[model samples]
Target chain A: MTEELNARDKEEVRQEESTHPGRSYRPDVDIFETAESLVLRADVPGVDESSVSVRLDDGVLSLEGRVSVQDYENLTPVATEYPIGNYLRRFQLSNDLDPEGIAARVTDGVLEVTFPKSAQAKPRQVQVTAG
Target chain B: MTRFRFASPFDSAGRLLTLQREVERASGNPFDAEQSPSGRGVFPSTNVFRDDDGLTLRMEVPGVSPADISVEARENTLTVSGERTIQIPEGTSYHRRERGAGRFARALQLPRDVDPTNVTATCKNGILTVRVAKSENAKPRQITVQAA
Candidate 1:
């Protein structure tokens, strides 16, 4: 079973993080695999549907989300923790996936990308002849 | 008012989650659980920014409805709190769970007093934004320069 994909150590992502020009962050993602599809759920707070961009090139899936924090001219900051930035992540895919069938949607700050398996990869039950 | 909690033998996993949660919760300010306004922890990572107009605080609390979140502004302290419960599909099993869920709160003491009556807050796409107007006295004013 390829269940090891779900147990991927977060440190691996950290190590894979490449230096980007602007302020970008690696969002937390959850991957679930079923018989027919592989689903990726990424948490990218402050980003809405219009600002998110998804691209697949050369077997690599890239998700980029740009979030602009609202500003209040009259207010001043007393404390800060997280800073506003973009969320970017890339994943390498195998040929078992049908890139043409991938679907994505962003809702309530979570982005879901579903990759359907190729027709040949799905399990099939063969018919037997009656004796 | 006080309450007591006892550990269950089979709840080791739950206990471990709680222990790890405590480490992050302590850095952020603490508050009472029932709809308490913001906590100081980084659980719901937040950003505090202010301009000449007012101050805005943004927090990441995905999957949480606006009704589940509560915000309170008093004097110089602003608190944000909410509960985010994980709703797992009945037939589906979770092979991995990295997202943190539960009731959380954090309170921040701003640099200046804010007008609680004029404050506004909105939650969309799992992010919470609060805009607080500074008190009249706390606002910056231009002083007349005498010609010397």
Candidate 2:
């Protein structure tokens, strides 16, 4: 069952990749899980909350962040150590997550997304009865 | 062995960058006393660029506040140190934590003798751009072409 779900998500991700032809860089992401929620953090420098957009549709979470500008009219970039481009990445959500409950925030160029787990999906401690 | 190392296609660009910097250092020119980026536990990647003015060091430190960061320059070494404080909500817990938490400090050598007083830094978006003006001799000045 897990494999089936993952494969489906992978297909969606592949579709997402081919759809965008413009230059897009993948933001480095960190994902951690707790008992009740899953947290995702992406390193997106040169982007603020206004330029970042998060969307969830049918278990596919798409994260897109655009850099306001890469070149300047007067200042010539003699040497560029880093590449400037938009960021795009798509993630597949499983049934265990509540897609409708997903929330995100951008702080200091870092985008954090929180996904709350469904009640039935959360980890629970089973009580023991002693006779 | 080298060919096998690049089997994974995920981070080929990053690996290529390191290799390019290494090649430049191997050439070993007078100006090549490279003050390269020594990324040691630095949150985001770093880049050091040199121009006629002096040098510019950029570090991608997302989520790190300007107040928490400190920079010190002595001789030719420029050290940038900072920490990103992790704030977990009161009633919430993290399931997956990919972004590193806690404090991190990274220091690197500078390419030229910079004017300490002239150094300026600005944090935009999440990138910290540091400009170190070159010393008097290092600054570009063209001598008058005498008509012989």
Give the candidate number with the greatest TM-score. Answer: 1
Candidate 2, which CAPRI tier? incorrect
Candidate 2, B1-148: lDDT as tens digits: 5545545433543443343443234322212123335412234355555556776666677778888788777766666767776666556554444555556545555654667567888887788888888788766679999999
Q: Show pairs that collide, candidate 2.
A: A30-B98, A31-B96, A32-B95, A32-B96, A32-B97, A33-B95, A33-B96, A34-B94, A34-B95
Tens-place lDDT digits, model 1, residues A20-79:
333456777777667788778787877888988889999999998766433322334444
Best-matching candidate per DockQ: 2
B1-148, model 1: which lDDT tens digit per residue? Answer: 3353465332433433343333233333222233233333345666565566666676777667789889887766777777776554344444445665677666666555557667899988888888777678877789999999
Q: Per-model C-alpha lDDT, please?
A: 0.64, 0.63
Where does model 2 exceed 4 Å of error? A1-23, A32-38, A68-84, A96-102, A115-131, B1-44, B50-52, B90-94, B142-148
User: What value does the lDDT take at residue B5 in candidate 2?
Assistant: 54
Q: After superposition, how far is residue A47 of candidate 1 from its true place, in Å?
A: 1.7
lDDT of 2 by residue, A1-131 (tens): 11100000001122345333334567767777777788888878878888788998887888988664432212234333345556788888778998878899888888999889999998788999998
Q: How many backbone clashes does candidate 1 have?
A: 23
* Each model's DockQ score: 0.14, 0.16
Give the Cα error of residue B58 in candidate 1, in Å. Answer: 1.5
Per-model B-chain TM-score = 0.63, 0.64
